[model samples]
Target: MPHPDLLFPPDREVRAIARELFALTRDLPLICPHGHVDPALIADDAPFGDPARLFVVPDHYVTRMLLSQGIPPAELGVPSVDGTTVQADGRKIWHLLAANWHLFRGTPSRLWLEQTFADVFGVETPLSPDTADDVYDLLSERLAEPAYRPRALFTRFGIETLATTESPLDDLSAHARLAAEGWGGPGGRVITTFRPDDVVDLEWAGWAERVERLGEVAGADTSTFTGYLTALRSRREAFIAAGATSSDHGHPTAATADLGPEGAAAVFERGLHGTATAADAESFRAHMILEFARMSIEDGLVMQLHPGSVRNHNRWLHATHGRDVGGDIPQATDYVRGLEPLLSRHGNDPRLRVVVYTLDETTFSREIAPLAGGYASVYIGAPWWFLDSPDGLRRFREAVTDTAGFYNTAGFVDDTRAFCSIPVRHAIARRVDAAHCARLVAEHRLDADEAAETVVDLAYRLPRRIFRLDRSAA
Candidate 1:
């Protein structure tokens, strides 16, 4: 499974240039400014359980494809909410994935998985019903080795720094431990990002309880609207103490509102009582985006707004399996009118850094690029979720470059929960960027030296600078 020319152009002259650019950036330390990898895994530094658990079970990208083709998640060892029925045998799960390998053809999941197998696990033979057991045994042996431990692999991955998302209620004990161990300090780094969706979204199930927990965590009286904002600000300060450089919002849309104190408090009262209407929920989320930006200005944490995914689209699956089980689907998102309120308030502020991500590709050229082009605070996020493939990556570069240009865009972030795929994901991104840059060189739109510099910026410099990851808070 050699991907020597995986995403490189077929033209020999163009590919030679791409290879040169790739050589310059292929081994740079990974800047995972945004992702969903559990910090507990890095803090605990434990050995991975088995091959199937490491590969198939935890990856929604892998499980979703299997589930889409009539395979129940239970059959693939994905635990239900109650843990009543999930495939318990690792070998059996591997066999199942092996039998259905063809389902991932032409998919990014397949490219990442195969690259991981070859590069990370040293597996050369293709996986299939025949080689499943052999591959499983080899992976089991490799995973048992000391180098395969979470912390060891963290170093092996050459990660300059990593950030994991957490709720406001999180105590950040793992981050504290990492800091105590000198991991999140000057040299080693693993920080947290504040994700307040559970408490901010009025329609979220258990929103009341999460807010109460937030009150306890922040030691604020959340019974009043003012106190709730205090609680949020307090928790954000706590996250900053734990080495957070950014705050994330996963709202359903890019909406923002600027209601004054009385109006905001009235909406908060309705939300606190669980009597808020659908419009109220939208209004509250919109208002909070503005508030989060204000907080970012005061605290210096970069703001990341990821919108447009309709989470848990399958109602039955959502009820049975809970969230992030590959049930989230992309929807069309409007950024211009939706973000007008917030942009009008803080778009020109040089102190604020807002990274905007969308699952909808349609918004890249027409809406997102233009917005980033105008606002000093806004930066267009990389192609994400459904648009993270090679073609998607190229399309993103093409779409946004014309308006936003390279500097107005944030560099690549994996946004993955799958740990082993980090290197492969970054490698693919580097290659795709090189290919894009080589084309610009070929067409004389950019000089070769300039393209080389741009490729490094896309790969290494921009993400570090944009996320403020280069700062030594400790």
Candidate 2:
């Protein structure tokens, strides 16, 4: 039997109203402005290998929860960093995930998985230990169909554009291929986002080598600080040519430092020698952030900063498994003090687009909203990472709406690795936003028509505008 709460918007009258509002915008093409999905997947346009990789391993939301329950990641088919096989049998992993599905009972992962199963694969039976084989077989069968290929699924999902993050060392060959083939010329678009985490942080492993490679790619000397910055600039241009419209930064904090050129050069010199103190490294990073903002003003690329994750908190897990396997945790972060330098420099600039995201909910009302509300260039990103659930999304809207209003925020970005869950995530976001809007209408704060329009804006229009996709060549 289907779950009683399966039908969203729970109240009949509210559900009817929400459904009516959803109908107006539910089919609007998706604008995935920011995500971590591999650009190569879209470039290759290959069929996914199996259900385990599709549903279990790539989804940190699913795997990390399972890991918390003492489930070994290897048993769930998570590949090792060295590319060794972990689990070859998909059925066993599916059964394990099914048996322990209760771990996600109250979580958004449960909601998304259920929606994916029902809406995408046409599965009506609930997933459980007994039904694991049945569900896996059904998904596998669907995967075999031509309609389920990456590009085909992108079209079916109504994704007008999807921006995938890429490291600085990357050649953007996949994005180049997509553009060369004109895949994004007419019906679909896949663009790259310049992610320079590996190159920016002097603390990162292989930073020196990655810096050299960045210089090599850009035909710069890279032995000096000026050469390094120039190489990054050139790479940004290259990414732009391949359809990129944004740059993403995953900093540990929202700190930004606007040091003068001499001060910045001193810090960069320390970084180059691998002898920089922690303070010097941080200052260099901050100075580079200011530089990135200046570059944004010049290049017309949006700047997205996702800060506050204490990445790889679990050293044992990181050693055994590596980063981004659900071991990262959030810490309280300060944005006001951290961002003061950058804001003082470029806050009034209309051409520079800086979207700030946080795992620290405390900042929404007190800091983020107020800053974004006032600044021409600043905007708050949607609920992200650990907070992308229903309750989290609701709190975000409630906390910021009074201060920032709707327009100061960028709409939803799925920020997911699980390709099949894209539509599922977007559907949940839309429904939640509509339900919130419905409450506003019920209270007479907003007319029904305005609420309806806001639903469409939140779902489709805001993301396009904030990500600057409408200006993109289609």
Best by TM-score: 1
Per-residue lDDT tens digits of candidate 1, residues 1-474?
A: 556777899999899999999999988989998999999999999999999998988888888888889998899888899878788999999999999998988999989988988888788778888999999998999999998898888998999889999999888888888999988633348988999999999999988888888889889999888999999999998888888889999999999988888888999899888899989999989999988899999998999999998989987778778898899999999999999999998999999999999998999999999999999999989889999999999999999999989988889999999988899999999999999999999888999999989999998889988988876521
Candidate 2 is scored at a TM of 0.95
* Candidate 2 residue lDDT tens string, 1-474: 224223346777677677777677678888898988888888898998888778887778888888888987888988777776788788888888999998999898988888887877777778888888888999899989988899888888988888888887887777778878886422238888889888998877778888888888899988887898899899998878777888999888889997788888777777777788878767877888999999999998899999899888988778778888877999998899999999998999888889999999989999999999989999999999889998899899999999899988899999988778898788778777887887777677989989988999889888888888877521
Model 1 segments more than 4 A misplaced: 185-188, 472-474
lDDT of each: 0.90, 0.84
Model 2 residue 428 lDDT score: 76
The TM-score of predicted model 1 comes to 0.98
